[model samples]
Target: MNTAPPHQQAALLRRYQHRIHRVPRNLVVQPTGFCNLDCTYCYLPDRDDKTPMPTAVAEAVARSASELVGGHHRKPLGLIWHAGEPLALGRRRFTELLQPFEELRRKGLLEHAVQTNATLIDDEWCDLLTEYGFRVGVSIDGPKDLTLRRTDRRGRPAFDRIMRGVERLQHRGVPFSLIAVVSRENITHPDRLLDFLAALRPVSIGLNIEESEGVNTERHPPTREQAIEFWLKVLAWSRRQPGGTAPVRELERLGRYLRMSRTQRADRAHLSRVDPLPTIARNGDVFLLSPELAGITAPTYNDFRAGNVLEQPISAILREAHRLSYVGEFLTGLEECESTCEFFDYCRGSQAGNRYFEHQTFAVAETDYCRVTEQAPVLALADTVRKERTT
Candidate 1:
C-alpha cells in the first residue's frame, strides 16, 4: 500500500543517514512471578512460579549488570524490576533484593524501575519507591467495571485493592505511571478510559493494544479499523483536554509512524529490542532480548539462555548475545528493512515476539505488524504531510 514514488522514497532514505541508537546495557530482573491478580490477558501466565530470586542471586545479577554497563563506559543501564508482581516479594525482601542495585546506582552504574500491579502499594512501599528513585509503572485497565476482570487466581475482583494501593502512591506523592491494555471490549470507549486516566493524574499513561501472548492467546485483538478509530479518538480527546495529564498512548501506531516520517527514526517510547535488554529469570538463567523467550523452554534444547548469572560474568553474557546468529541476523534484517522500504526510516522493524509468532524465527521480518503499524500508517502520514506542505 505504501507506493511512494521512487524519487520520494530515495529522498526520504537520504534524509535518514544516521544509524539506529543501540542501547549498551540494561536488565529486566524477574524477582518473582508471584502476582496477586490474574488478569485475563496476562502474557506472563507461564511464569506462574512463586519462587523468589535468592538475595545472593539478586546480588550476583546486579554485579553482572554493573560490570556490563561499566565495560560499556558506564552507560546508565536500566534495571527493571519485572515479575508476576515484584511487590509480591513483600517489602523487606524486595528492599533486600534492591540493595545491591541501590549500591550500584550510588556508584553511577545503573538506573532502576519497577513494573507492578499496584495492589500492594502502601505508604511503606511508596516511601521505598520514592527513596530509591524507582520509576513505577502500574498495570490497571480503565474504570472499575473494566478492571474487575483483573482478578486473583480464585476469581476475586481486584479493582478496589489496586485502587487503594494507587491512592497510597498518589497520597504519598510518589512518582508513578500507568499501563493499560486495550481490548475489543474497551476499544470503542476511549473517552471513558481517557477520563478515568485523567482522574488518576499519573505522570504518563501507556496504552498497549491487546496481543495474543501467554494465557492471553484466547483474547481477540481489535480490527485494524477499530484500532485506528480508537487511537484517533484518543488523540482528539488528548488535544481537547485543558489541564488534564495527557496520556502517552504507547501503541498508537499512527503517532509513531508520523514521528518516524518527520524525524526519519523509530520512536523509542515503547520497549526496545530484546537482545541488549536481558531478562534474568528465577533460576538465575539470563535470557537475552525478552522475558517471552524464557517461556519458550523446550524439553530437548535450551537455546534461549545466554548464561546463568550465578555462574558467569556479565561480560560473558554480552559477548554471547553478540555471538548469537539470531542477533546478528536480526540486526541485518533491520538494516535491510531500513534500506529497502519507503517506510524504513520510520520503523524499528518488527518486534521479536511478533516475528516469532509470524515467522517462527527472530531473524525474519514480521509483515503483519509491519503492515498494520508501519506501512499503512506511513502511507497515510505521507499523504497528510504532503498535503500540508502543498497548502
Candidate 2:
C-alpha cells in the first residue's frame, strides 16, 4: 500500500465517492419490541422489550420523510414498519404507528409498507389494512417443515396460524408479499418451496437467508453451486407459472440484468435496488445501510447509530456520516467492487451489514453473502442463456 499524505488520500477517496453515494428514502421503523413467536435464529437482540416507539421518534420520521421527498437523488420515500412483531401491536396500535405516514401517503408523496409474521392478522387487521391501503409483507419460511425455527413462544408450530392470517388477507382482497428465510433445510428444496409459495398467490416472493447478524452466531451459507442451482430452478418454475405465482425477487434481479446488458449503460451499471436504507429504532436512534444493522452492533461502529434525527436534522446526520471510518471503508470497498467484480453493474457491492457482520470488516471486497445473493443468481441466468444458445 502506498503511504500518501492524509489530504491526498482524502482526495483519492473523494474521486471515487460517486461509486458509493447514498441518500436512502426508505425508512425502516421498529414500531415495537414485542412478538408472540420466538424464532430460533432471530438476530434481534431486544425482541422481548414491550416498549412502543416514542411519539418523538415517529414525528422525527415524518419530518425526515417530508425532507426526503424533495431530495435531488432520492427515491420515493417509503416508511417500512418492522420489528419483533408489528402485528402484535394490534390494529389500534398499528394504526397509531402509521399516523405519521398517513398524511404523506395521502399526499401521494410516500409509500407505506409493513412486514409481519402474519400470525396475528385477523379479520379486523385485514379490514384496517384494506381501509388504509397499506402494503404488507408476510414472513413465512415457505412450507411447514421449513419453518421449524420459526415457532411460537411455546415452541409449537405457528405455520398453520400464519397460513390462516394469509388466508384472511386473501379473502379480504388485500395485497401482500411473502418473505421466506432460506435456512439449511429450505435452501436445498427449491421445488417444494416454489410450489408452496406459488399456491399462495402473493404479490411477490422475497428470500432472506439465515446469516450471522445481531445475536445469531452462525450462518448456514450455501455452496456457490447449490445457490446457482436453486435460483435457476426458481427462475425455471417462475417462467412456467405466469398467472399463478407472484414475481420472485431473484428472478426480478435477473430481469434487471438482462435489460441492463441489452442497454449496456455504464453509468447505471453499478446500482442496487436502492442505496443503504435508513433505519430508525423505537426510541429514536437512527442507523443507515441494511435494515439488519438497526439491531446489530459492530466493534468499530458500536451500535452504528450515525445520529438521531430527534436531536439533529436528518440531513445533518447524513452529512456527519462522512466521519465514520467504517463508512469511509465501506465506500472504498464499494469502489473496489465497482472496479473489480463482474456483477458490480447489477448488485453494486452487496450490503454493508452483510459484509461487516460476516467478515468483520467493511473494507473487504466481498463476502460469502454476495457469492449466493449477487453472483449466483446472475450466473444461473447466464448459464441458462449459454445452454439455450448451444441447443
lDDT of each: 0.69, 0.78
Residue pairs with colliding backbones in model 2 are 269-345
Taking all chains together, each candidate's TM-score versus the true structure is 0.82, 0.91
Candidate 1 local lDDT, 130-228, one digit each (tens): 888888898888998777668987899888888998899888888788988778878789899978987898988887767654445666676667765
lDDT of 2 by residue, 188-271 (tens): 898888789868988889987567767777656567778888888877877788575588987787787678779886756445
Which segments of candidate 1 are over 4 A away from where they belong? 1-25, 71-75, 247-275, 299-303, 332-336, 339-341, 367-391
Candidate 2 at 299: error in angstroms? Answer: 4.7
Candidate 2: where is the Cα deviation over 4 Å?
1-17, 20-22, 71-75, 266-274
Candidate 2 whole-model C-alpha lDDT, 0 to 1: 0.78
- Winning model by lDDT: 2
List all candidate RMSDs to the true structure: 7.4, 3.0
